[model samples]
Target: MRHRPATYLEAEEVRAILARPNPATVEGGRDYALLLFLYNTGARVSEAADLCWSDLQLTAPRLVCLHGKGRKDRLLPLWRDTVAALHRLRMNAQPDRQPHVFLNRRGEALSRDGIAYILRRHVQGATQALPTLDRKRITPHVLRHSCAVALLQSGTDITVIRDYLGHASIATTGRYLSTNLQTKRDALETFWQHAGIRPVRAKAWKPTPNLLAFLDSL
Candidate 1:
């Protein structure tokens, strides 16, 4: 069956969701960091859930090694904000032997379901500030789609996004090209420029004499 175009959040909507988590508390900090990480790296929910401290390089040239499908691993650069949020989460975390980057109230590694629940809760809370979010079904994978679209909008190469998302084929990444309205508008503008097609304004319409006579008969 054909799948629908992926649902994604605009950058501002993403910012609103990220703001929902109160970073002052441990769980709140983790939730924020988790959401930021998903947006930053376009990681699959499973990859994010399975992340470990050993998978990260939090220092200069911050990077993460995401273990993807079929044991394929890809390295992604971390955004400065992502690094900062993660740092705060680490500092606030209760001392524990858990190696996972994200943990629950019981200090166990967060499962994929746990991550989804966190995203859903935050999305609901964010809806008050961004009513548009209420119309979209936001999920962890939607964040992945949003990341890909954001990269495309910023002029990042499609192949780079393919590898960034750890897609086995470039074809999977190409789907993002069709989902962005701004990208389509840009393409159309470029096409018009190259084709020498000048936009013409439509003349205002008035009823024809025959049509006016017919209406008058009624």
Candidate 2:
């Protein structure tokens, strides 16, 4: 059996991927917006594709994630741009549009692989440019990692990232933070600044009887 490849995208690679022009056809802008949404929210491919029109608060600034892994549910705030993108997609959709957030050319929901293919089409070139990325293949999971890393770089707490990603363990979400060099450097320096060093001393002073008696009286 073929093993699933690891997914992680660096900050610069995500920027390059997002910089591409949206396709001129069906669900193009919405798809591009989905990529940005995942990069910002760290949502899984299925989670983003499974999102429903009703899942979003059309008149508000938030979205509900109902189809998370294990049927777990959560709410993720949407940026104005992300909300606008969803609006565009919703406007273009047919009157009896399906609930799925992402649709194929036939107006059917996109599978996980379909979403992966969409992302790869835009990200392959960007991935190839990176000297560290030898595979030249990019996927939705990479966008998820990019989101987590970006948040960590911005000083988001580990516990928060864990909650946002809906991880069962904080350790799972912690791996993303480990790749952020700047965060690690800042953490190290902060620790050094607050840690005062003292030499081991030979003094073993004991309280005098008079001092003890005075203390007892007080």
Candidate 3:
């Protein structure tokens, strides 16, 4: 049996989800930053949960080293907004620092469930505003799929997305290629453009011989 196609948030849904925080909440910044980081990095929930401060390199060329399945490591570049979010979530002035980049309210490392809860809360809040979000279950895999789909839609080469997602095989990354509507639209548009152009050809001409006379002579 064929499996369902992967689902991803549209660019607008991403914007609405990130617009969740209000000033009254102390943890608002932290929560917003965490979700943005998750979406931007396309890191797995476990990968994000296991992320330590030591794994980040937020310099001129901001990037993160995500430890994905099979203990394999892959590096991905970060957007400026994501880098800024991590910057805003700077560690507390406490003497002993929490090893993880993201932490619970109690200053402990964030678990996968903790991160998922945060994502769910934000997605739920956005649901009232965007009813479309209600129809789907937004999980970490969905966020990961969103990342790949976003890159594909933006015209990033497939091989690059494969490396970015750290897939064991290029075929796994190729799932995005098979189902992207934008890709099909682009292909169809190109076909239409080519079809509109007619090739140079010889002009139509009347027959040189007289058909009735030729037949009678034969």
Candidate 4:
């Protein structure tokens, strides 16, 4: 498809994207806060768009419920800032609203493309600060991938990541951690060492000076 996301953004790039939207006004605040909600919750674009008022549980231990693929529901914890952003977004957009979390300028529920367009608008702004963004196709899915991979890099268990993404199989979620070849190599090397593989020294095979002289004479 024309909108396929090729890669993920680093944490810093995410910050740049968050800083793009001017939250001085309600509309700007909604856009800015929506990005935070996506990054912090690691929710899919559809999940974020499909969110209802009741899905939010913003309390001491903040959480949001996302209804994902296969009509399954997954609950994820939200950071304090994420909760704050959602509060702002809800206050501004849902003043008299009910079901959906995000709405268009016309007060209709946001569609997948609408969310993608919003992300793209901010991504272009982020490019100036994070030049690496220039090479990437940053979609809402990429943000989700970034969240999963960032957790992996920070040493979170793969199974936890699978559950976080509501993935049916760990193999499906493992694609995020597999992006780092070095991590895999390190793990394999550790396994080999623990398996009692002996390390060989190439220096031990070097010919002696006398042997080299005899070979030269021969």
Candidate 5:
């Protein structure tokens, strides 16, 4: 079978992973939380890794991405659970680095590759423990796909998902839409049902002189 991206992690799997004792420390756990946050949010690895403290605001429960693909900036809303994870992370974070949202042990910003490495390790650990998910490998980008798929699966609008993911084109976000087989079937059934009920009838009456006059006037 062809290897494809892991679109969604079943709710039970998600629970299992989250239920596991976080193996990383205060700083490291914060990084891990941020990684999960990014994965859950469908944020680009770079955008999440370079995020600053000021970029996140609890008021709107959102994060402002400064540098996105094509150097564009966009605002991303956080899910309630994602926000909770962030709060927990911030509480244990070191005081030396109040600037960066994700900091290394040295209190410096984490590199994009560093974040990817963290995700790789985390997935490896999570999969090793969960033998049931051995065939379903996860990665940073896969997490991104999972976020989009989760939204699409939950009956979210495709345009909204596109905007949330900061996608420049709707086509870029369509991949997530493809995984929603139930949504597609529902749409097709609705279309056929509506088509069956709506009868196409031709106009039987001839145009009156007044109608002709109106058309002439126009």
Candidate 6:
């Protein structure tokens, strides 16, 4: 079966969702960091859940190494805001030998379900400000899709997105091309300008005399 187009948030909607998390409180701090990390790296919930401090290079040129499916590992650069949120979260984190970066209230590694719950809670709050959020079902994976579409809209190369998302084939990442209408509109505008096609309606067609005679004969 063919895959459905990805469901993703617009950049403004993503901002509204990110704004829902309060970073002043402990749980809020972790939630903020987790959400930012998800958007920044486009990491699968499993990858984020399995993330370890050792996998992070949070200093200058911050990066995270994601261990993806099939034992494939990829490094992704961390945005400054993401790094700052994570740094604050780390400072407030309790001392533990547990290797996971994101933990539950019990100080255990966060599960995929836990991540989904966090996203749902914040998205619910975000919907108050941005009603569009309520129309679409937002999941942790949807955040991943949002990240991919956001990157595509910014004119990032598709091959790079495929690598960034850790897809085995570029075909998987190409789906974003069809999902992003802004990119399509921009492409159409560019084509019209380059091809010298005016944005005017075509005149209605009328049958020629020879064509009418041929039809009457028939």
Q: lDDT (CA) for every model shown?
A: 0.71, 0.58, 0.63, 0.66, 0.55, 0.70
User: Between prediction 1 and prediction 6, which has the larger TM-score?
Assistant: 6
Flag the better candidate by TM-score, 2 or 3.
Answer: 3
* lDDT for position 123 in model 3: 90
- Residue 198, candidate 1: C-alpha displacement in angstroms: 36
- Quote the lDDT for 209 in model 5: 45
Q: Is candidate 1 or 4 superior in lDDT?
A: 1
In model 5, the clashing pairs are none
**Candidate 2 off by > 4 Å:** 1-7, 23-25, 125-136, 168-218
Task: Give the alpha carbon lDDT tens digit for every residue of 1-218 in model 6.
Answer: 33344576666677788888899998999998998888777788999999988888889756787899888776666766778998998896654577788999988999999999999999999999989999898888887776665555555555566667776422325465334323433432332232211233323334344433322221
State the TM-score for model 2: 0.67
**Lowest-lDDT window of 10 residues in candidate 1?**
191-200
**Candidate 6 — which residues are off by over 4 angstroms?**
1-3, 94-96, 168-218
Model 4: per-residue Cα lDDT over 1-218, one tens digit each? 12322266666677788889888877778787788777665688888898888888878556776788877766666666767877877776554555787888888888999999999999998898888999888889887766654554444555555566666422325455344323333332332232211332211123334433322221
Quick one: best TM-score, which candidate?
6
Best by lDDT: 1
User: What is the clash count of model 4?
Assistant: 0
- Clash count, predicted structure 5: 0
Q: Residues 1-218, candidate 5, lDDT per residue (tens digit)?
A: 33332344543445445444363557556744675576455677777777776777655524444467776665554544556667777776553545777776677788787777766565566676677656776556655665554454445666565556666432325455344333433432332232211332322323344433322221
| Backbone clashes in model 4, listed as residue pairs | none
Q: Tens digit of lDDT per residue, candidate 1, span 1-218?
A: 33334566666778789889998888899999999899777899999999988888889757787898877776666766778988897785544477889988888889999999999999999999989999998889888876766655555555555666776432325455334323433432332232211333323334344433322221
Per-residue alpha-carbon lDDT of model 2 for 1-218, expressed as tens digits? 33333345555556567656364545578676777677656688878778777777756535544457766665555555566777777777763658777888888888898888877776665555554555555667766655554444444565555566666422324455344323433432332222201112222323344423322221
lDDT of 3 at 98: 71
- Local distance difference test, candidate 1: 0.71
